[model samples]
Target chain A: MKLYELIIIGAGPAGLTAGIYAARKKMDFIIITEDIGGMTKYSWDIENYLGYQFITGPELVEKFREHINEFNVEIREGQKVIEVLKDEENFKISTKTDTYFTKTIIIATGRRPKELNVKGEKEFRNKGITYCATCDAPLFRDKIVGVIGGGNSGLDAVLQLSRIAKKIYLIEIKDHLTGDFFVINKIKKIDKVEIFTNTKVVEIYGDKFVQGIKIIKNNEIIELKVDGLFVEIGSIPNSEIIDFVEKNQYNEIIVDCKNRTSHKGVFAAGDVTNVFAKQIIVACGEGAKAAISSFEYLKYL
Target chain B: MEKKVIVYSTKTCPYCKLAKEFLKNNNIEFIDYDVGEDREKLEEMIKKSGQMGVPTIDIDGEIIVGFDKERLKQVLGI
Candidate 1:
């Protein structure tokens, strides 16, 4: 087992940016992730990423990939990191397929879509329920679909489904749509869409397939007959696999301004960290910080 | 009618890409119904498999969900 200088455990904005920086600094590092681009690929449209006024999530990810491709960075795509731990002076990174040893580690494992924990939610998973709008919007074409969560993710689903589904039921547990003004304004013009605020999904009902979803709004329980349900309530940090590191209540790894974790040499970055603002550009900066910090630490050793 | 191999997929699904590649690698000619492009095919897909996940393969009425390699091998006899 060849031990590298650094191991970054994600391929999202943070991990990719870190890889590019590490490569430029001539630091030997490897990125292990289940997929590249992470949740950014699921984004319908991105307007806030600096240098581009507007670009689709996939398009932005493509640009990132192209930028990283310029460097001879080693990215082990399609590999899921299962466990990460300290091995004396080096860190042991474990994936489903293999284990790697590195002097430093950067955890950029993003987040997964939070599941709607209701009755029949799990039974109907992949049956008539999905998470990624970019991945499953087409499967619900011309069918009545309900989207859970009123944030940007739910709005993203609505924007994507508006062109595909026959009708959309945007169910938000809050009192109002909490997405950006641009997206909120766009969906407002679509007559095929219905927005329900201050509504909570209490139960999901079905037999062989998803028949409908039960909800409570204004103190009234109502059953909505639909073909599919998309849970986009938000996400929890992907940091549960490694408990040796300090984490917040949301399971996000605690990191300092320099992206250093509680344990020396084990760094954390991106949405998996305690960073309040989980954005692509922000993650990139933090990733670079983690890489540079790791580089500095490696120099002393 | 010949034994048809149809793959109901989305444009962005990784499993769908793998399923298509798996079929192509086995010299299996399959009809790709991209749900993202063809709305009608999407409805047909949901009706048949009762699944929303992409890369649902229909081999002459035998439906397999996701990129199940072992199941694909069994169904295609490859």
Candidate 2:
């Protein structure tokens, strides 16, 4: 097995950016990722990505892919890194199918959506439920659907579903919608969407398909009949595989200014890191810093 | 070759793509069902694996949820 200079763990914003920089530096590196875009694919509208005033998450990620494709880097897409073991001088990155020995490692494995975990959530999954609003919104055209959570994700789901679904029911456990005021202002114009605050989705009722959901609003259980349900509460970091890495209370990898993690020669970037701002631009900056840092660390050996 | 291998996956899901790539690299002939696209395939995958997560592999009658290479090798006799 050939030992590469660096092996990046994810293909999201940070991983892709790192790949570009590594290729420019003429580093013997390969990106082993389960997918190309990571969590960035779920963003409905990206306004703060710097270049483009407003581009969709998937759209921006596509551009990132196009830029990375210009380089001579090899991206082993769809490979989930199971563990990264440190051995003396090198690191062993193991995926579900393959393993690699590398002088340095970059972990950009982002996050996955948080599940509803309510009754029938499992039973009705993919049947009439989905996490991505932009991806599955078209499927619910002319159909009545429900959106759970009250944050930006939930509001984003409503925005997408509003364009297609006949009617939408937005449910939030909190007393008020905590999303941006601009988004709330946009939602106000939609007459078909009914907002239910301080509501908890206690149960999802379905058998072969999703029939409806049971919600508790002001201590009263009400069943809202809908064809689909989009749960967009939040996301959890994909840092479970690397148990050796030091993580914060939220399970985000602990990284310094240069993207160096708790372990030597091992770095993390993107939303998976303890970076305060989990933005696309921040991820890219951190990824570049990580690549440079990793290159500098490689000089010692 | 006697056992049938079927993979249920989504397009955007990285793990699903990797699972399929692993099988292809091993030269295993299998049918891939895109759960994210097809409603019927999604239902079929759920009924078989009882998992909401993508990259569910169905080897003959055995249902393996998520991408597990060690398990796949054992089942495939690789």
Candidate 3:
């Protein structure tokens, strides 16, 4: 197998940024990701990322890809990294169908959306309770739907569902809506969205197709009849594939300022690390930091 | 009809993997093609479904896109 100076996992903002910097340095590197865009591809619009006043996450990452393409960084898309092991002097990275040896590895496999553990949630996944409203909103056109959570994604789902669904129940577990101001304002303008703060989804009742959802808010339990339910509470890191690495109680890898892991020659970045914030910009910054640190570690060897 | 299962796919697609897994889990055999690698088949896929995305499934000529596991199970009677 060919050996690389560095190997970067994931292709999200963090991974892509790392690739840009690594490529600029003319380092021998390869990036392995199942999709060129990670979970951020699901995002429709992002006004927070710097440089662009407002742009879609996918569009921004496209620019990152274009920049990295200018260099010789080998990109292996449609491949999921199955294993990462440290050998005597090099790290062994294995995918489902291929293997590679690298002097250093950067783990940037960000987080994935958390699932609603309600009964029938999985059974009615494509049938009703969905995580990506953008991907499945058309399925509930002119139908009643419920959106759980008060985060940015939840707010985005409410706004999108408001356009397609006849009635939308925006349920939140907090006393106040916690999404971006613009999203909340947009959702407010749409009278179709029924805001229910401090709400908890107890169960998802459906058979073959989604029929309704049960929620508890402020010591009061209520059932909202709907055809679809979109769960957007939050995300948990995608660390299952690398669970062998030392991680915190929350499953985030503990990395130093340079993104070095407990194991030598192993580094991690992005949402997989115990970073203060889990934003696209922050992940990208961390990815750059990790790549630089990986370069320094290579010099020591 | 012996449950005609047809998988419209691209040569390089990861979503097609999930769709194939769905068929395999149900023990349903399917005929698939790499439309991305074949220009004629790519046009056929677009014309048949008017979709530009890959991993489109045709169960008894009913069109579906992406993995769409649930819809595949329902249409294929899996």
What does TM-score give for chain A of every model?
Answer: 0.86, 0.90, 0.85
Q: Rank the candidates by lDDT, best first.
A: 1, 2, 3
Q: Output the lDDT of residue A42, model 1.
A: 68
- How well does chain B match by TM-score in each candidate? 0.93, 0.94, 0.88
After superposing candidate 1 on the true structure, give the runs of residues whose Cα lies further than 4 Å from its correct spot: A47-56, A59-72, A138-142, A162-167, A181-193, A218-220, B1-40, B55-78
The local distance difference test score of each candidate is 0.87, 0.85, 0.80
Clashing pairs in 2: A34-A78, A34-B14, A35-B14, A78-B18
Q: Which ten residues in a row have the lowest lDDT in candidate 2 chain A?
A: A132-141
* lDDT digits (tens) for residues B1-78 of candidate 3: 667777766433445655786688788989887653455665576677754455778777799977766687678775
Model 1 lDDT per residue over B1-78, tens place: 446899989876756776787788888999998887787887798789876678889998999988788888888877
Give residue A12's lDDT in candidate 1 (0 to 100).
94
Q: Which ten residues in a row have the lowest lDDT in candidate 3 chain A?
A: A132-141
> Which regions of candidate 2 deviate over 4 angstroms?
A44-47, A53-59, A185-190, B1-78
lDDT of 2 by residue, B1-78 (tens): 468999887665555666787899999999998765677887787688654556789998898877688899999999
CAPRI-style docking class of model 2 based on DockQ: incorrect
TM-score, structure 1 vs. true: 0.80
lDDT of 3 by residue, A59-153 (tens): 67567778878877789988999888777878888899988899888999998889878777867765667677665564456779898898888
Clashing pairs in 3: none
Model 2 chain B weakest lDDT span, ten residues long: B9-18
Question: For model 2, how does the per-residue alpha-carbon lDDT over A54-127 read when each residue is reduced to its tens digit?
Answer: 98776787698889989878999867888888877888888888889998999888888999889898777867
